[model samples]
Target: MPLSERKVVARRVTLELANLVIKYGRPIVVNLGVGIPAMVGEVVAEEEVEDLITITVESGTWGGRPLYGPDFGVSLGAFAVISVPDQFTMYEGGVIDAASLGFLQIDAQGNVNSFYAKDRIPGPGGFPAIASGAPEIYYAGLFTAGKGAKYEIGNGRLKIVSDGEIVKFVKKVDKVGCSSKVMLEQGKRVLYITERAVFRLTPEGPELLEVAPGVDLEKDVLAKMEFSPIMRREPEQMDERIFGHRRMNIKKELLKAIRA
Candidate 1:
């Protein structure tokens, strides 16, 4: 069966993150948050780099594929399953090398609202602890929200059939789930990854880093955002392979990059 467009976008974001892990060229522990961030475990597992990239979930599981939905708090083949408090202890103590978290909204200042909205109240769930502790954080999710968004993917490209009505990047988030100020003071590396664009949180503010292929810079990206991002240079195109259906063979790429 073919993967849905949403799932494909999730995989693409996950693979991009996997590439970042590979670039470290050494063993590291990484925490996966809920939603699209949970897909990282599946991507790492498929890449066969579990030994190098240790997967951790807030539910106290480590070194396995992180489950989603009803099974969100467990891993399929975890090497360890400690108490939830112990897992949080590691996070609050800065034991993890990195973390990937989902966001409900992101502001011009890079503040993230992962939980809470005008209509919902999921509350902040391990986001505060993990975001505060991890030296590096990647915020992952779709480019837009709300109902009726549509897209097409083929031939290594993405075509926006109809965009979501809700704009995720805003002037100010409804609530600040993760503070950009604190992260900057702590000197953490931060990135926002969406289906069509990537932004890096810098001293100057959010900088536009990369854009997916076939997406219009003006109509599809810049025009949709609430505020302008720093364009230090022409943004690079996101890797073309992510748009296709075939396996990325990320293990081979990781090994090659490590060897070089």
Candidate 2:
């Protein structure tokens, strides 16, 4: 894919994560942490969702607006910026809800491995800090099945699907970003979403919340997953509106922004 197209995918994926956050808003302020979560901060600022839901980034961008074009705010100001320490304080204080994090791997218990990858590809960032700060943590990534998404079905059973190149959405993570054992002990809420399905951790194991539309064959979803989830009726549609929000309102400046 072209670099330009890749950037568009990144923006769209980030917006999907943010849109989920906006749809599931709480009555209180929700502090969005770094990376993809920060892009959510941009989405909220743009009012593509709702202003009642506040956004704060650990990188000191709070309630910021988006800068148009492929630059991703490279040549423009970061709107509604805040201080680094303040963001951390809010997070560490448990002020954040539903942190949608990107990870190299995520296990059934919701432990994430983002700090490092196989042979140590990606270095650790603030994963531990954010996990500590946020009670309700969600891990997300694109779906794939190769040699990576493997588990012996020791606990129960694993009906394998297409093997993934990277072992994300695995039965057991090679490293510990967070721990399922710890989450079980703490009774914390854990969620996992890929392009294919959504799973949540329970005492029994991972429960299938929903599956991605069109890929509804049990083996197709199961074959790709490391652990077996209780069968669900069907997954939900991501919605066409998610792709086209420009028609929501048409301001002259909005049109000029797109053109310019």
Which candidate comes out best when scored by TM-score?
A: 1
191 Cα displacement, candidate 1 (Å):
0.5
**Against the hidden reference, what TM-scores do the models get?**
0.93, 0.65
Over 4 Å off, model 1:
1-5, 12-23, 256-260
In order, the Cα lDDT scores of the candidates are 0.83, 0.51
Report the alpha-carbon TM-score of model 2 versus the true structure: 0.65
Could you give candidate 1's per-residue lDDT for residues 1-260 as a string of tens digits? 14445555556656655666677766678898998788767767765777767889998998878886577878898999999999999999999888889998988998999998887756998899999999889898888998989898877788888888999999899999988998999999998988888899987778999898999999999999999998999999987777777766777766666667
Q: Which stretches of candidate 2 lie over 4 Å from their true place?
A: 1-28, 31-47, 66-80, 145-164, 232-260
Superposition-based RMSD of candidate 2 using all C-alpha atoms, in angstroms: 9.1
Alpha carbon lDDT of residue 229, candidate 1? 93
